[model samples]
Target: MKKHVAWHIVRACLLPAVLFSSRALADCAQDFARDNAYKPHAGAHRMHERKLPLSLLDGQWVPTLKQEIINTISEVVPPNATRITSDGLFGPIGLVVIGDRGWIRANGDAAWEPLNAAESKEILDGAFTSYLSFNRMSDLSCTRAEHNGRPARVYHYKMPSELQIGSHSEITAYFDDQTGLPVHVEVEDGNPRQRAKSTVSIAFDSAIAIQPPETAGQTPRAGNADPSGRRKSLYKHPPGEAL
Candidate 1:
């Protein structure tokens, strides 16, 4: 009878271990099957699918406003630039090129020379992505307001950081009701002491290219002079001169 009791206790312990192992294996198999089945659906679900209805524009249209803002910003082709004056307006004031290397006219001559690439990169990166990330829209609330003499959607978004004194910042985006093209974006950082304001404007134009100048690979003109006149150093732009 004692031997029988010992055998029963050992059997009970073994049965639980066996059952637990089988259940764990079954759960892993089920997880694998679910992962395989959802692989195709995952891609489809990630895309933006819903279209906004026209009649919903009367009061605070949150989703439509958010989508429009995202679409406009995302459409900006990376590193797109053109010749602009020192004042930051596009024109033929001086030769300017933007790409892997940014170049500007040094002496107002037709000759295009390289700008300080590191400085330009810092400014551009800060102006675009860094600023966007610093003040991202946490909760988008839309309100109807007059934008450029037409009724448009004005969105209020919560500022991501505690440095901003106000609980939220306002983003006023003017969009064409029919075509959904964004005309302007306005953001206000609500501190009277804040000196810098963030604003980005988009313009559509057909002619923007970053073609290398004809003098890109040519030997330096100083090297072609008499050997005595040519400087021995290979450095193109020396210190104290603007790059």
Candidate 2:
């Protein structure tokens, strides 16, 4: 379990070290996001899937590489990043967070529930993998650069060969210049057919407080997120079909 105080540490640049997929992985990226109708211009596919320089991180693969990246994230990504968000092939995946706990609105239900510490750690992985759990991979990347108008540090690691040839997951984060609260967190799902990006830049502190429900019934109490516990698309149509 990530330390409960991990929430306090969240306000730092560590907002979104990573990004999601849903359903089975017969074809991970392709099938995982098929239920989502969003697709980028087929022309933009190449650019969207473009691999930024791997030199983003400082060193080559070492035995302690994963741990080293973890340490750097604990030091860098958080102190500067303000908000954490994810984007699927569709759009902003409905993940809301207040302090350390976050909620995923599943099954078209309006109600929201708290995410367990382990669950949150998986998403923010000190790297990115939206809905998927964080597993160590070889040849990860890290760097600090200005993306868009916002200045942020970026981190990403290689996806498995099976996911796709150019396939990888990455995120750029920004911090609220004034309060130092997280202002923006974004993830890039590298598929051109069904491009996905999730962002979280709104509702923080007193702006939008997400408290636990008074009654236990209102809270789904989903621990570690069992396969059966995940939320399916609200209305349900086949993958690639329009909502």
Which candidate has the highest TM-score of all?
1
Clashes of 2: 25
TM-score computed on alpha carbons, candidate 1: 0.32
lDDT of each: 0.32, 0.32
Assess candidate 2 and give its lDDT: 0.32
Across 132-225, the per-residue lDDT of candidate 1 in tens digits comes to 2213344444456665686654444444322244455554444444433344555554332222133545444334343545664333333222
Q: What is the lDDT of residue 147 in candidate 2?
A: 46
Estimate TM-scores for all models.
0.32, 0.31
How well does candidate 1 score on lDDT at residue 141? Answer: 43
Residue-level lDDT tens digits of model 2 in 42-146: 111000111111111133312211111121011112211112322221222234333455555432222344677676554344322122223323233344455
Question: How many pairs collide in each candidate, listed in order?
Answer: 0, 25
| Candidate 1 deviant stretches above 4 angstroms | 1-135, 149-151, 160-169, 190-192, 195-202, 207-243
